[model samples]
Target: MKEKQFTTRAVHAGERADFSQINSVVTPIYPSVGYTFADSHELDAVLGGEQPGYVYSPRYANPTVAALETAVANLESAEAAIALPSGMAAVHLALLGAGVRAGSHVVVAADIYGATYSLVQGIFTELGATVHLVDVLDLKKIEAILAQEKVSALLVETISNPLMKVADLPKLAELAHVHHAKLLVDNTFCSPYLCNPLTFGADMVIHSATKFIGGHGDVMAGLVATSAELKAEMVRLNKLLGSSLGPFEAWLAHRGLKTLPLRMRQQCQNALHIASWLQTHPKISQVNYAFLPSHPQFELMNQLTNGKGGGAVFSFEVRGAGKPEIFALMDALELIQPATSLGDIYSLTLYPAISSHRSLTPAERHKLGIGDGLLRLSAGIEDVADIQADLAQALNKIGHGFDG
Candidate 1:
């Protein structure tokens, strides 16, 4: 064979190097948009789904992303998994995969993530789908709604955001299956380390891998774990929507997932300690940690997680405090950072009224038991004493009599 020219060499210098003999401890990132095959026949076979291979990234898949999907599927005990650009994309794809479409009926938890609420109430509703937002804990109401309509999907968070309300997954799954509806559970809070929703009979398990899965808070990704049949459908839908996870982000998330058990263990311990301490504090009006006996769904949470832990995040109310006082407490904190996100290595605080549940009106928030004085704290793998000290000092700085 003749040597290539300089210009041709520039484009083909390191293209398609074979590493089949190389064994690496970690998965390497594959950034190529297009892949090559030994012959056109093999390429045709791969593209036609007759063989397991990657062709194009945006339309098909990537090696790194596929590795992450496999890992998540194994962790969640699902037959297959799919990675997405973000948590909302996972939710949207899960809904679509469950056969939600125009003229479909979707039953959603009333107090879900703010953006998710808007996604169903605004976009799905505008598309002519009927959405019924009901209390997920009220199984009777859900049964009645299912009986009254031909529902397509029932969506709920395993441990709801901001408030930390645990859903009855087993019962909900049974109800949905009996009604011929698919049940999709957001397992972001109770990660696979604590709970596997698929084992509890859920049709689909969703995760915002940007949270605990990417423990360091560096990568943004989402995941859906389900049967292979459903995964193929989601893959097809995503090919048209172009909401696939990137190779770099997939590599980062996969690395983060390796330490999920360790991170979640310490974070859960710290969260329970903080929740217990806050209950004893005079300024704290309410505490909402499922591990605590005070939580309404404590028993159900234990059954779901098998007492692994109550997760790393919980919400509490500051007595006689509104936005102004809440702001003062947040500003007073030194060790605990006041941030918008949760499930990171750094202990952080978020006010639901302005962050997680901001989309809902005050009346709607209040109706769901999310008050203006509520503050959510995500306990990191830090010392419990240090975290409580920061909260104590912050609480002491703000006076209860302050009005907003």
Candidate 2:
């Protein structure tokens, strides 16, 4: 229990116990909204958190969901983990757990996923939190804000959205601790397989399990891995917020997680090949995969992933392609899915300006270097050659105006 390989932990962690006495190979789903106890005293004990048992679904917890949480915690090497209905819910819970209340200060990455950007700037701000959007790479600026304000949390993505900027986790964690701010990393892009943010001193490691964790796109769930104290706080908050993941979704996510190591290895391999191919293509002006030597944070990425290749997801810019041309290319693709989500068995593509970053204004997006021609791709565990050929044909169709 003290030491296990990542792949072994992936398949075996948080399973084969607790919920069943029948030695079920898989974690069984407990769909009941409430649980029965031996007696009222036992129920009261469980309800008061004096003992470990599920009493309710929405407010308290469920066996299936708890199993998933345990697995995620084990994988991320955290004291505990909580599963939520969606990734945004996990983000919300992490913010609250980090003490992002009214009159609090929060420093967030400017280039994060669009919904996260809106949540910090919109809802958190409306609730009276002073949010500062900064370039996560600029540690000095972040430090300055943290020093000046009583910042509650410093939120950032391990790998930035639309642009594969690798965050220096250890440095950021140190800076946040120095300023008494909690470092909360959204580890969705890298997953537990590629990077364990908590190991680098992050106070909270969050995941949109719907993506890479689920790996099949059938479930919508989120998870937060942190110290047991933080998890307790989130669980208490969830009692009132009611954003916990359902048992069925939890089961689905848990099942998908069993193959995380396997799926990630192939996805990473496919992405590396595709990103390299895209970089050399005349139709691609830029490819933002962190593992590539050309990437700005290639070294940092290798340091973080131990040279596992950037990740399954990466972004690129099409040569002379605007929204219209981007649409043309996506339409021409036969194998790759022109969908919104990523980290599935099938390849997926999204136009950041229209999808993930759509909430931001054109000027705001351009300021963040998310051009209209930018496209985000999540490589699947498919044949690299087939995937490459799909992109090749798509580029050919959108070849009306090219650098060549």
Candidate 3:
């Protein structure tokens, strides 16, 4: 048989077609927290890793969660995958599983998600790991850092949060491998539909399944895809930390995966349309969408995403505005919700200064080009014209300046 297409696999992968007891078309949510053993022999065999069956605890593995993990692993072309309670949990486990420890050296991208920056700078640093944050686009600087320090893992995002900068995954992976370091990618922005970091030589791929994977915004989950050996370590760590995904959330994430290909396609179309329109608006200072030809990494994005239009989220700077004006614009929006989350069925917008990047100091945000007027928009599967109307009216509200 020929290899199935992405959409086909998305719908059918990890499905057990040969179920005997009441075959349901959809995968049923196995809410059982623990699986029973036939006898003591079976339990011992399963516990000792001599048999192929689920253990007594959901933390070790739940049938529903396992199905979701398998589906994501198949999509990512990874050896195995582990599902967790949240994105940050996946990040913490990935770093720890990839051998990041006290007194270890790690390299990370400067323009990463704010929470990620906090985790590395605060938690990891407190644990005695020295993290070198650099602009990943600057190959020379990365090389200099690698030359100076024995790095454990080179962490980066496929498409940076808010800023939408595209990382050169293949090149970064090569650099990491040469220095005996692993390349760990946070693939939440791109998702498996847009990009697969493992295919490009990443040692591990992390996703905030809460965002794109759980497209409806109802469920919160995270996933880490890696080689079998690393996956075992992640699973062990997840079990020990008690951060495994609940069966219900795992089922929701799996259902969300079925429509990922469709959702992602529409999202890319909507983002391109909205980004192009925003660029022409006089009130907009700069747009940070890679699909725009004017973007710095346009070519790289095209090459990496295979012309998928830079996923669904982008950030743009509002001209002549500060926090007050930006707040007014958000308040005036009727269609686009002023929320902190992304990749939902409804269009959403967030203010980076007070939301995603609020962890950083004002000076630090300024250094990273995240200004008070910068707004990150997550284009939803809405009518392009309607989305534009909402954005235009909001911009108009801020155009005349805040009267109060």
Candidate 4:
């Protein structure tokens, strides 16, 4: 079969719509729990793995979930895919399947999502893996870590959460291959529509699909896309750990995925518009969006972003404004939602230090360059002028020595 373009792939791939039965034009939700076999030989084949068949129970495998996996794998252009209960579950399953053993060592980027950081620092470390936090932007620092540490795997996000920093995937992939370590990229921020990490030599790509794939703040799911060999391992680990996503959630993710290309591009446009407006606002501090010319790594961002934009998520410091002042501004905003999670159609904002990375100590946060007054914004598909006006109003009303 010929490879389809991005728009065609997004809408047509894995869309096994049944148009004849009940005249349904979309993929049907297979709300089944068990499958009936024809004879003893079929049952034996399923048990022995001689043939591919669904058996035992629905939690392990369901038709609806299978469609979701196919849809996600197609989006990522990977050999196979799996749907987990949540994005974090996909991360855990991907790591475990990649042979992250008790004595294994991992090199995690410093600007990783806070929950991901805690996972590496607390859980992975406790499990005997020596997790090294790396400054991904500093190639020399990454090289130093790779040379000294016995890194079995290197993990980082395409765009680091809150920080909105982009990792040099090609450089990192080369380094990982040289050191015989698997390169894992969390592509939750810039989905396949923006960049394909595998094309750039990444070994594994994982996502908290709940963000982009769900696209509407309604579902919680995760997806791991990789080579056939790695996907087989992930499947084994997923079944062993019972991290499979529910059928309904998988269906929701698949439903949302069909509109992914349209939604992401719109969100990207809106984000750039808002980010540019914020840069000129006197009350705003430093906005860390790659789309803006003032960004330190604008050149590098252009290379990774492919002109699609700096993604819908970004962060900005409120200068001398403290946590209380920041909270007041966030709460006063009528259009923007003051909540956790992003990639939804509605604008969502959160204080990183207290919300996303609350587990990190003050020293650790300072080391990672996250500030108490920093605000992370997930720009949505709302009208740019309307959103800007609300933010402007909020900043104006709160006058607690607010960064002006």
Q: What does each candidate score in C-alpha RMSD?
A: 1.3, 8.4, 8.5, 8.5
Tell me the tens digit of each residue's lDDT in model 4 across 1-404: 87889999898776555545575667778765666667889989887899888774445688788888887778787888878888888888878877788888898888799888888888899988988888878888878878887778899998888887888889999998898889999999998778778878888899888898889999999988888899888877667777778788888999999998888888888888888888887767788886787877676667876877778898988767877888888889999999779999998999998988999987888788888778999988888888888888998888766555
Steric clash count of candidate 2: 0
**In model 2, which regions exceed 4 Å deviation?**
1-21, 401-404
lDDT of each: 0.92, 0.92, 0.90, 0.84
Deviation from native of the Cα of residue 147 in model 1, angstroms: 0.6
Q: Residue pairs in steric clash, candidate 3?
A: none
Q: In model 4, which residue pairs have backbone atoms overlapping below 3 Å?
A: none
The regions of model 3 sitting more than 4 angstroms off are 1-20, 402-404
Name the best candidate (by lDDT).
1
1-404 per-residue lDDT for model 2 (tens digits): 47999999998797645644577888898897877788999999987779998877845888898899999999999999999999999999999999889999999999999999999999999999999999989989998998999999999999999898889999999999999999999999999999999989999999999999999989999999999999989888888888878899999999999999999999999999999888888878889998889888999999888887688999999877788888888889999999989999999999999889999999999999999889999999989999999999778776766553
lDDT of 3 at 29: 86
Clashes of each: 0, 0, 0, 0
**Comparing 1 and 3 by TM-score, which wins?**
1
Question: How does candidate 2 fare on TM-score?
Answer: 0.94
Deviation of model 2 at 322, angstroms = 0.7
TM-score of each: 0.98, 0.94, 0.94, 0.92
The positional error of residue 101 in candidate 2, measured at the CA in angstroms, is 0.7
